[model samples]
Target chain A: MKDGPDIARIASLVGDPARANMLTALMTGAALTASELALEGGVTLPTASSHLAKLIEGGLLTVAAQGRHRYYGLAGPQVASMLEAIMGVAAGVGPKRARPGPREPAMREARVCYDHLAGEHAVKMMDTFLARDILVRDGQEIRLGPNSHSYFTAVGIDVEKLGPSRRPVCRDCLDWSVRRSHLAGQLGAAILDKILTEKWARREKDSRVITFSPKGRQAFERAFLEV
Target chain B: MKDGPDIARIASLVGDPARANMLTALMTGAALTASELALEGGVTLPTASSHLAKLIEGGLLTVAAQGRHRYYGLAGPQVASMLEAIMGVAAGVGPKRARPGPREPAMREARVCYDHLAGEHAVKMMDTFLARDILVRDGQEIRLGPNSHSYFTAVGIDVEKLGPSRRPVCRDCLDWSVRRSHLAGQLGAAILDKILTEKWARREKDSRVITFSPKGRQAFERAFLEV
Candidate 1:
């Protein structure tokens, strides 16, 4: 209470079950309305409205009112980064749940990060690119190195048309389940699309996990030198 | 269920009350042991152990066993990112909490972020520097621009002695509370330290909130130009 507000404010805002549930729903980065969140959190609409108010007051979220429907989203990328940092500690510190049976191994392997791919394999893919000089770190953003131009060009990425001003590349989107960086941004979306179209990876119904077909595995190995 | 396992996987992982509480504690970015977390979550050690096992097996966490104590943390920065995304959604979509009353207000204004200064004021300070051509963004880092050396020198920051390779001159640390980037790195730390030393700000124990005194406010206004 003595430390003005800052992290404590953000922390307390995230500490509650209803609020946490609402935030978890927003993880996909899409804007949602109040009633939808109320159902997601299993609370009444009025109660959800109060919670939304607190979050906005706390500066953890922003509200966009379009006529009768008001859409809310995270205030900015910094909020995402902070939540990620906390999730890291939570995962590290919490007790693990019990998994039964032959364990759906695919969940542990690679998964979708929002709309992109992430996991041990994803990290390996990133590493392969780095080793091949396909991508280089440019401050917080990753840039497609000059050497990797051919790979993208071969894959039909049309990097030349993107021009020099716009950053036409992939960003390291952090994967919660896989605990590694996955390709994000325009390139990431394109890659995800390509995989789905080629039937290399299929999205599992009701979950973020992606199951790779034998053909997909082979393709991934061939395309990015999958580790 | 049609979106594959991504939504369900993330939601179920965070659905449990005890696990959620444990995650709330870890949001501070500090690692804790299973027993410590057990106590915090109001669960038995064995129950905490089981949860920890599930989280680890689920690939949401990694463990570093030192002697008899096992230290756990989010698998990596990717996991952190995922968690943040989820939290953003929750904060955006959830119900609100009642106010706990103001115990301190100054601390909420500005404070140190890891190693640098953060909050609204810190962000404004960065803007000031950029406007004056005293700082330049270099991809993932910030460097002194053409006029920065002389500008900082006039402001009492020894640029020549600091050296170019010693540390990052400037970069933005994502501020969770403000959901914006704040000044980070050695320069940030220096400014924060100077503020505290000159009685411009004071720290609130057990939290990172910093309060600015009347004199401190005036000094900061004079030094940083209206931040």
Candidate 2:
């Protein structure tokens, strides 16, 4: 990747209209092929390839070559952060008169991010644990507090078992939209997966929104003390 | 805000290359005029005017008239967030490559977020306070913990007198770079202002970067245990 004095290079890469469209498609966090992205961006295959090359060269994207096809994604968290920071400002104005319609209320209320729980419900659940002294904040790290181990057991989740997997049992995720902390680690992700597997929530098609089922509504209320 | 089926209208408004450039310039957080932003975006005055009008019409920008010139800025936090979200995807592949250099280090260290604090230093500062029981996070709200009020008093800020102003004494700002909480709100802004006023830190001209003076560094270390 060009490390310095590459502003012109980076700018020109994004200055293209076709490339910008493809990038937007990937923003949803789904992996797609060059052909798929080309169609999404309304560009020819060769043009998309060129754009993908430039993105990869800039360290803004990473490409995984699998057999006859190649998949491209943002390079890393830093790339994502850069885009997020820019969006935070860009979202403020310009063609903003047409506000995106109100998100599905259910998903906005409670949902998942990647594998973990997020949105308002997740924040509230974390709040309940902290208020009850089940979790403690320690220097950008979250630790189970007091009788957290027993508490998890009482709640029917085995916190200890989560450690064996690469998935984290507990992790802190910053909710970009709400600008608050939400649970992400292995434990948190497991809990969300559990909810889905048990048919508590269903992911909205073509959207990140998660719709809670009737049973999920009752179960979540009981588990997390929803009023 | 239309809050209607106008994704195409909104996209077209943002879709133009030159307009996107002007918006990106404002994305850095400074309010700029037609002439200044035109130069930044590499467009002519008439072109800039048209772009600005579209942006303003699209509700992505708001203008504050100052005599003959109009200064445009992002309307609010939501606008900023939307831009960020868009660019989150748009920046995937720029045409140019930036050579990694010394300048990158300073940017990664500390920067400004509109009127708030961001970056690693701010994130760590907030984390330390939370870990040491100096601050507490309650859902989306941030508050001083058990002895935090006394601690603030002992440190020399007159929280009681400042009450008439009704400004929040402390707040948790989510650092865009670190993806963690940082101190913000009235107190965070005040502290930054004080540091600059005392010549402990200085802003890089035309940039969000902050440079700490030797004396200011010592003061920060003594006061906040900042490294």
Candidate 3:
């Protein structure tokens, strides 16, 4: 038998419904207080605290204490990707829910997957990049081409400055909603941050959706799509 | 909170250590009996039965009864992929084990991942396919091009007959051992099966390792590599 890493401990941490909900809520890339996560998970504060403690101890999440409150977020991008992978498998294998949430449409349109963009808009952006030869796949690795530097620079993201990090510059992460690949890694996070900084889109309060204004949509298309 | 499929329930099924060991043992893709799994998991037969029942009920596994013996295996490829993904994240996050198992090196060299091959050999095969243009990646999708039809057909896997399945013909599954993409789909399964049938390799009893003879290894490289 293959003796790999112990997966049961980490999985069991996410196995609880309330903890799963808390982790899902954190997929927005926002740090939330224990009470807030409790509300998000539909559990009491004590219960949420216990779960959060377990998650932090399990290394799937990290916490920071600021002033009177401690905030929790996913430990890093790996945790987020693992959660997304789980969601992908769960979508295909598990039974469908009877009633979809109100945020379903918005989430399917655009949402924050960890620190990057996901859903339809993200998929469209990825396709545009691929079609334009801004990104190329060398085997399983996704790398930015010579043209990508100038293109990202024109969009206010300094691709040069994103180098030297332990994190990859380009990564293809599976989108749970679209069942397609989206941009991830340092470049992915930078692009999403640039989009928000430009006011082209804004993340919905207390949710994962990224809502775009009409002007913002037009601007995004003119910049990314028209290429 | 978006109520998609319940991920926690399925994750919890994989959370228990005994169950996790059993599932890991099943990664060999062998239909093992309850007693075998119990021995592998270091659990009593009755306890293994309970865990197996829970896994079956949760749709993570399926069982078949032949005569007085009941055999259990992963429900489908999705389950196996989910487990691999979990192992990936766990490897990164979890605490390291004190002593590595004896089979660790061999498993990393060549092993069965569900119905497909994984580890170094599998990665090499995938790299060869990509280099030869037998398998072309169009964005996130891996497609067999014009050359692949003849190439696979010559290898005894009729590419034409692999159509019409809900499952994909070419898939890029991340190899947990290699941290690279390997072929996984109908074509992947077909190639692995061919190796076994040709006596090029045989799955080690009660293990995931696919032991290849010296002659078999030479033949495999000649067929897959020197293209």
Candidate 3 error regions (>4 Å): A22-81, A96-106, A109-117, A129-174, A182-227, B1-5, B65-69
What is model 3's native contact fraction? 0.67
lDDT sort, best first: 3, 1, 2
TM-score of each: 0.50, 0.60, 0.76
Q: What ranking of all candidate models by TM-score puts the best one first? A: 3, 2, 1
lDDT of candidate 3 over A155-206, digit per residue (tens): 7788889989656788877777887788888888898897899999999888
Please tell me which model should have the higher TM-score, number 1 or number 2. Answer: 2
Off by over 4 Å in 1: A1-13, A25-40, A43-85, A98-104, A160-169, B1-227
Runs in model 2 lying further than 4 Å from the true structure = A1-55, A63-74, A80-103, A110-216, A223-227, B1-30, B54-60, B74-113, B116-183, B199-227
**All candidates in order of DockQ, best leading:** 3, 2, 1
Best by TM-score: 3
Docking level of model 1: incorrect
List of clashing residue pairs for candidate 3: none
Positional deviation of residue B133's Cα in model 3 after best superposition, in angstroms: 2.0
What is candidate 3's local distance difference test score? 0.83
For candidate 3, give the lDDT of residue B119.
86
Chain B of candidate 2 vs. true chain B, TM: 0.74
